[model samples]
Target chain A: MTDVPSYLSPTGQEIVFLLLGVVAVGAALLVVTTRQLVHAALWLVVCLGALAGCYLVLTAEFVAWVQVLIYVGAVVVLLLFGIMLTRAPIGRAADLDSRNRPVAAVVATATAIVLVTVVIDGFRTAYAPLEPGGGSAREIGSSVFRTWVLPFEVLSVLLLAALVGAIVLSRTDIRGRR
Target chain B: MHVVYPAVVSALLFSIGVYGVLARRNTILVLMSVELMLNAVNLNLVVFDVWLRDRLHSGQVLTLFVIVIAAAEVGLGLAIILALYRNRATVDLDRLRALAEFPVPSPEDADDHLPENATEETAGQASRASAATGPTRPPGRDDTPEATP
Candidate 1:
């Protein structure tokens, strides 16, 4: 029912996914390596936004929007607040990284190799053609409310507990100071 | 087009996260790395869920749960880190050995790194301690941490 681009069918979508993937991975790398804490958080925003784009490409519109709203909006903001409250080295932390760079790089590379190999091999033959309502909000809502209601309620409780725990832990004077 | 496409990307993202957690000393950086890893898992879950075409969309639902758990983890983790920094002056994981029961053994006490008389003094103490304390390792002697005047 769409008339955007006949040639844009698979080739165009693949190119978009590839571009978003590149952005996501590069930003994720920055989030880890940047000495400045604020910059690292900003890079994480880029990475998370790009992943939301990937979800869009995968035809999971509901998930894509939720990713943007929750991850990019709420989570990153909370992290930034945490950084500011903790007096993070926003300018330059010369000692932000330790002497384990070489070891960690080796471990990360090996894990990447193993994960890529296994996932690619296992899903080589699998494919999912796009459908109009395959992953729309209506569909996701149905699944969530019917088959996954209990876990959803549990998650709400977990969030509430986290909120209270954070308040209790961060307060300097538990009883007196305002 | 292929399911492996997003899966591979997620793997690479997870690897970057692993490196961040291992190499970065700042507790905040470590927390951010964990978020990255969780995002990677979310990507894979949604991709597979769509690929399998499960009517329940279990993968996406689970991703939702993971997102909540990540939020909770960050909240607690940052609070702990803040409390730790307030108690101590630093957040360096290597430098913060507070959890260790006994003080870490430093070569500074042994003086083995010293130029001359290194072995003579340490060995003398070693023999003396073996004689006094039986076959087990001897307590610190001349250069003993508690021996300082």
Candidate 2:
């Protein structure tokens, strides 16, 4: 029930994926553990960029670009604004960490082990060959509108709600002074 | 070469995110950690979308939805954090225990390192609040005003 992938050797793609994976994982590790707030944000950008590269290697071109646009371009820049607004310590600082690090490490490691084991066991030998035009924008758009209409619309509503909630929460009325 | 590579990498990213959330004291850093976790989930979705070879590309669609939702969450989360900082001065999670039965003084207070702007803004709010309440109004905290983690 299987055929060899003729497009290119899997090794090339695999190596690229591994490279991107290492970059993404290493940067993500920094994102959490960095004491400098701005450096943490920048590291998050690197992690996101590497994930986008992974998506490209997997042949999900649209998703990869969207990953860059939404994550590296938008979300991280927004996070930087948050840091500025809150006046987070710009450089390294010891107060950045809490005292529960040992507990955190345990929980995180346990979760990673469980998830990795499940994934490896479940998808051990499955392979899906990529065909050209598989992840074209037209294809994704048509499917998104036709099959996933409800969810797409619901997300639009959710975004609107979040927008309103944020504005309401942050309102500071000098008029209340009078 | 194994499909497991992407999966394992995603897992590592998610684990790091968990550690960030649990161990970081700053609110913005916590938000950044949440983003890391979300990105890990996106990686898994795309990897599987290609692996399953589904006709409709449901995995990628779902990833799109997730990205949009993550954006919405960050927008709202940052707004709330900004508001908290404006009111309380410091964005330290341990110090922002307003809901505790015995509220602890913020770390800024213990160290007497309250930012000058925080003090000024709070004083201005207090002065304005008091004038608005007037002598006839009790100095009690009303539901109209409140403050955050």
Q: Pick the candidate with the highest TM-score.
A: 2
What local lDDT score does residue A108 receive in model 2, on the 0 to 100 scale?
95
Candidate DockQ values, in order, are 0.34, 0.55
Provide all candidates' interface root-mean-square deviations: 5.3, 2.6
TM-score of 2: 0.83
Error of 2 at A175 (Å): 8.5
Across residues A36-58, which tens digit of lDDT does each residue of candidate 1 receive? 88999999999999999998988
| Per-prediction share of native contacts kept | 0.71, 0.86
Predicted candidate 2 versus true structure: per-residue lDDT over A1-178, tens digit per residue: 1753432555777889899999999998888887788999899989898898888888888888998999888899999999887766767787888778889999999998998899879766766555557777898999999999999999999999999988877776522332
Root-mean-square deviation of every model: 9.0, 5.3
Q: Model 2, residue B65: what's the lDDT?
A: 94
